[model samples]
Target: MCLLFRLYFLARRMHLSWVKSALVLWRNIMIKVGIAGITGYTGEELIRCLYQHPKVKISSLYARIEKPIHFSSIAPRFNKKIDLMCEPLNAEHMGDNCDIVFLALPHTVSMEFVPFLLKKGKRVIDLSADYRIPKDSYELWYKHEHTDSENLTQAVYGLPEINREKIKGAKLLSNPGCYPTSIILGLAPISKLISQCLIEPIIDSKSGTSGAGKKAEASFLFTEVDENLRCYKANEHQHIPEIEHFLSYEAGANIKVHFSPHLLPVRRGIMSTIYLNHESFSSIENIQKMYNDFYKNEPFVRVRPLGKFPEILDVAETNYCDIGIKFARGMLIIVSVIDNLLKGASGQAVQNMNIMCGFDEKEGLF
Candidate 1:
């Protein structure tokens, strides 16, 4: 009889411990997010960020070819922490299964799924060029037909400092390109100068190799990229049209500028040197006041004080975009840099999602 009482006491103690553990687990649970392209590097980064977040949980991980394996295979460091398998990407089920869906597909692919997700009332953040360009410009550069014309026109350019308010209300968030986001924020204040039709800002932008993604190509391999610093799209990059369109829209004029992109040997980040007519320098105080006031309330944008410029390392793993402007040779030379993968792509998409879903803008972003 004494032995039986001891056994009962042991069982009760074990039960109570499990109950307490379950309560703790429930209390600190995270907000589940669905990643639609789990095979890519950006997708892997999101997995990494969320795995560490106190309030974020990855719900659905999707990969077209790698649909039946653990996420660790693609990103080994993730190892056991993310032992989940990826499923196929289907718009029909995405909205029902996950709280939010992130599309890291190619440019035109998002158009096919984004509308359906929105219709099903799922908030979407696209990390592709599909939603970045206007319908006509997208067709011009991407060389494909965009069926969701309305969404493209209304899509908010997801530069947190500039469009956070619109992002909060948007059902579909159109995250900007790596180079464009970096370049635009740096040159925005001078946009008024250009708007007066009195200034022309020329952007000479360069990026590190990681912007090419994990895909294979003779051009991106070590042999080709090492000791190589060459310009690819001289004046005809897809992002050019996007920059022009947004600038024109913001400045209320037909904005045109010389856009050039170059490839650097390093792995990530971009620096754009822009030249604006010296007549548009405005006062340094006015310039500082404008950029500071513009991004004053914004969390991710930092406008360096006069004579202080932003460096790539300053924002390497962060969601922030830093800007520094100076006048030169009757030209306003502006330089901007970003991680190309973070602030330029996956990170911004998450930022837009936070706004659209009414979650804390900083949740899981830092």
Candidate 2:
């Protein structure tokens, strides 16, 4: 009788020990994420998305401040939810605290911290133009000397639709620019068709003022932007090379675009209308079907029905890219829309993080 009682207690103790071990393993799986430019627009958006992520904990927030301040003090919307302090920018501290670090800084700034974070064995997703293009192209376009060329060669372009597999194994991710995100996705499905039959495509893209970033610029002021639609960079936008580079890779041929970016009178979205003139014989139905097939399994890309169009409102504040196709006259028109800050910047950053960490691709996006 005593032997039976002892066996029962021993078995129960083993079961409890197993349960405790499982709990510890589960807790370790939650990733500790950090954001660098935490006071900027993209940084704030990153916080908002990461706060809702089931497998993440925002371990650190860095900004260009002299002292630590509450994160909610910088962005009031996160008042009750994220009660954390935003510390001064320190690459060493960030690397020590976070398993993954997101660089939401401006173009030239991200390059400064990326190399250090990478050395510390931390995965990095950079939301800037620093690592997107080659060194020479970056200097020619942004007028800034490329400081980090070693990592530039290895950084994976973070567009999940086209580079999902690459992103999965990426330790350094270069998030696509806002304009390139909309334009590339719009042109990706028909890349082969364009190379075979089309001439240089004409791209007319318009974006909200928020694409400019959170800065005190005279041109982006309310009086200047409100009730105004202005075309600024025509055929000379910095994103021209980036759009051509990736699209060319997709089509296996050199693809150039006459990209014209306009400033819209809104706050947060991008709409790109691409005019592709092809000499081949294909009906509008076939083209629509191709687009549907191309993005059918994609989680964030939504192809609109034939003869239907997408507006900026369709993908506003969401990580979705809504694309529409139409054949008018001798031109094949493709319209693509996305929130410049979400799919264009921070939401896509988190998506890359999810892919790198082996989490579900759409874990926190929806």
Q: Which residue runs of candidate 2 sit more than 4 Å off their true CA positions? A: 1-28
lDDT for model 1, please: 0.74
Q: Please list the residue runs of candidate 1 whose C-alpha ends up more than 4 Å from where it truly belongs after superposition.
A: 1-30
Q: Over the stretch 228-322, how does candidate 2's per-residue lDDT look in tens digits? A: 99998799999988999999989999888899999999999999998877755258887888899999999999998887999999899999999
| lDDT of the structure predicted as candidate 2 | 0.87
Tens digits of lDDT, candidate 1, 1-366 = 223322333433455675444344332444567888767767776676666666667777887763467767766787877777777777677756665678888778878888888786566788888888767888989899999987777777787766666776666777888888887787676576677865656889888887877768889899998998989889899888888877776777878878889999988788787777665465667777788787778778888877677888888888888888775556556667777888888777776766654457777777
Please provide TM-scores, in order, for all candidate models, with all chains considered together.
0.87, 0.91
Task: Count the clashes in each prediction.
Answer: 3, 0
In terms of lDDT, the best-performing candidate is 2
RMSD (Å) per prediction: 10.1, 8.0
Q: What is the lDDT for 225 in model 2?
A: 95
Candidate 2: worst 10 consecutive residues by lDDT?
A: 1-10
